[model samples]
Target: MYFVYDIGGTFIKFALMENNGNIKMKDKFPTTAKSAEELVAQMVEKFLPYKKAVKGIAVSCPGVVDSEKGVIYQGGSLLFMHEKNLAEMLARECHVPVVLQNDAKSAALAELWLGVAKDVHSATILTLGSGVGGGIIMDGKLQSGYHLMAGEVSYMESDFDTEKLRGEFFGRTGSAVELIKRIATKKNLTDKKDGEQVFALIAHGDEEANAIFNDYIYGLAVQILNIQYLIDPEIIAIGGGISAQPIVVERLNEAVAQIKAANPFHAAKPNIVTCRFQNDANLYGALYNFFIQFADEVI
Candidate 1:
């Protein structure tokens, strides 16, 4: 058995999983740890009970990860995670070897192994959440650039300006969180995070809602198109809580079509698709990463 964990800003999901990707036991709780030590302590407390039964642990977390060296360079909202070697930190407490991988890269590996990209040599996956996080794969292998930031699509600039900090990055604009927040603020909805209500409005073809939705889709489509031109992957999978809406992919295709029509000098547009594993992808990916990292000891 193996212990797999997918750490998010708001929650940390952990599972006791078999080598074959079958989850034996799983659970999650709010991520209230304010610092790296607290985060380690929190995981130790939860994992201690099952420590004796597991071979090792694998973790998937946000930001630029030094997978080989087990260091987290930039941890999105987990501000205290910078410069911390979580794998080393956890191993010291649990006495079990631990491997760390960037969350998006882990998700991509899972897809390549058994999910949507299994049959494709080249693919890209974008997880639209608190901020857009994703990974790129080519030649049947995960590609972490020289800087270890290849799949960091969130930092891609949507609009640039010389005057200001130019914070209009895809990570912010292309995020589902921003989409909902924009709609909620414009519609004056009581709860800004009510995505169900927001999607309901879009589903019913509310003109005001559709107006904002169109802009969001346009931005997202353009970004996808940019990626399409860059890598020209066989397919681009969209995964996240908002992706469950079903309309997102459909609308994205429509917008992509519009862009192709306007550009006229068209190339093959991206073959966009939905991700097979949504929320649970990280857990499976983490397990796969662990297996790859500790191949000698694992079955």
Candidate 2:
């Protein structure tokens, strides 16, 4: 058995997997702790019982990570700046081999291995939720550019207005979460638990909700166009909590159609599909990475 972990800013998801990619057990908990050491300690305490059965571990995290070095360069939203040798720490504590990857890259691997990108040689995955996260797969392999941050699509600028709105209209980081928060605040809507609620209101014909949704979709479409021009992937997969809403997908498609109509290109437009593995793609992809890295020892 091997262990897979998907560490996000708000939560950490874990799964124990067999050699054949079946999950034996899975669990999740809050990721916010005082420090990385505390978080690792907590994980060790929870996973110690199954240590003997596990062969290795794979981790997917949100940040600028040095995958080759097994150190986190920067924790974007997690606020973990100090260099932490994740693989070494885990290997010493659990006595097993460990592999690490960026969360977006892991999710793309999941899609390529078992989800929407299974048959495609090149693809891009966009996880649209708290933030717009992305991963690029080229020639059937994950692409981590010069510094292992190639598929970071959120930082791509659309227009001057977007740059201005990022902080004033959105928030400090100008993230998807900030955009949603701004929409909810402007609409005077309370109890906004997730992105789905915002979409639900839009579906109910809320004018302010509609306007916010339109702008969000337009910004996303601009990014998609940029990605399409850059990699020209065979397909683009959409993941994350917001992608669960059918209306969002419909609106996104509409925006894409508008773009295609505006600028006719010789290459066919790539098929945009929803991710098959929803929220668990990262965890499963982490397991896939572990298997790929330590296949010989696993069996």
Candidate 3:
């Protein structure tokens, strides 16, 4: 058995998995802890009962992770996670070996192992939610780049100098949160409107909402095109909470088509697809990563 965790800014999801990839038990709770130590204590308490049964713990978190060393160089939305070796921190408390994997990379590994990219040798996963995160696979292996920042697509510049002053990068411009926020602000809706509320307006034939939705999809498509031109992966899988909406992939494809028609000189476009595993991807991916990291031991 193995203990698996997918740590996010708002929540920390953990599960116990059997060797055959079946989840024995799983649960999650809101993340109220502020620092690494507090988070480690929470995990230790949750994982204590299974300490005698599990072989090790696997963690998937948001950051530029030093997978080999089990350290995080930078944390994305979780500001307090920077420069923390969470694996070591957790291991010391639980008295079990722990492996850390970047959340985006872990999700990509899950796709490669069991989801949409199963048959492909080269693929990329773009997780589009509050922020855009990415994972890349080339030659049937995860590519972490020299600095382990290879698939950090959130920082990609979408409009270049136009929004630099506003810190509006691809993550902000191509995210569901940004779309909803923009629509809410433009349409004079109540403050703190979410994606569901904004999309409801679009569904009801609100012109302003439709316009924002179209522009958001356009930005995502262009970013996908840029990713294609750079890596040219076999397929680009879009994941995250917003990707659950059935129309996202369809609308993005339409936008890609429009761009292709406008820029006839650019002959190549990416093959885009949606992830099969939505919210649970990180958990499964963390398990897959654990297996890969300890293949010899497990086998």
Point to the candidate with the largest TM-score. Answer: 1
lDDT of 2 at 189: 67
TM-score ranking of the models: 1, 3, 2
lDDT of each: 0.89, 0.77, 0.86
Kindly list the per-residue Cα lDDT of model 3 for residues 227-257, writing each as its tens digit. Answer: 8988999999999887887778988898899
| Per-residue accuracy of model 1 over 1-299 as CA lDDT, tens digit each | 88888999889999999878899999998999999999999999889999999889899998799888889988877989999999999999999889999998988888887899989969999989878888898988888899999999988996788789675889888889988988988899999999999999999988888999999889999999889989999999998888888999999999999989998987867998998888899998888878777777545
lDDT of 2 by residue, 237-266 (tens): 888876677776687778889877877772
lDDT of 1: 0.89
Top candidate, metric lDDT: 1
**Any runs in candidate 2 off by more than 4 Å, and if so which?**
161-176, 263-268, 297-299
Clashes of 3: 0
With a 3 Å backbone cut-off (N, CA, C), the pairs that clash in candidate 1 are: none
The alpha-carbon RMSD values of the candidates against the true structure, listed in the order shown, are: 1.5, 3.1, 2.1
Write down the TM-score for model 3. Answer: 0.93
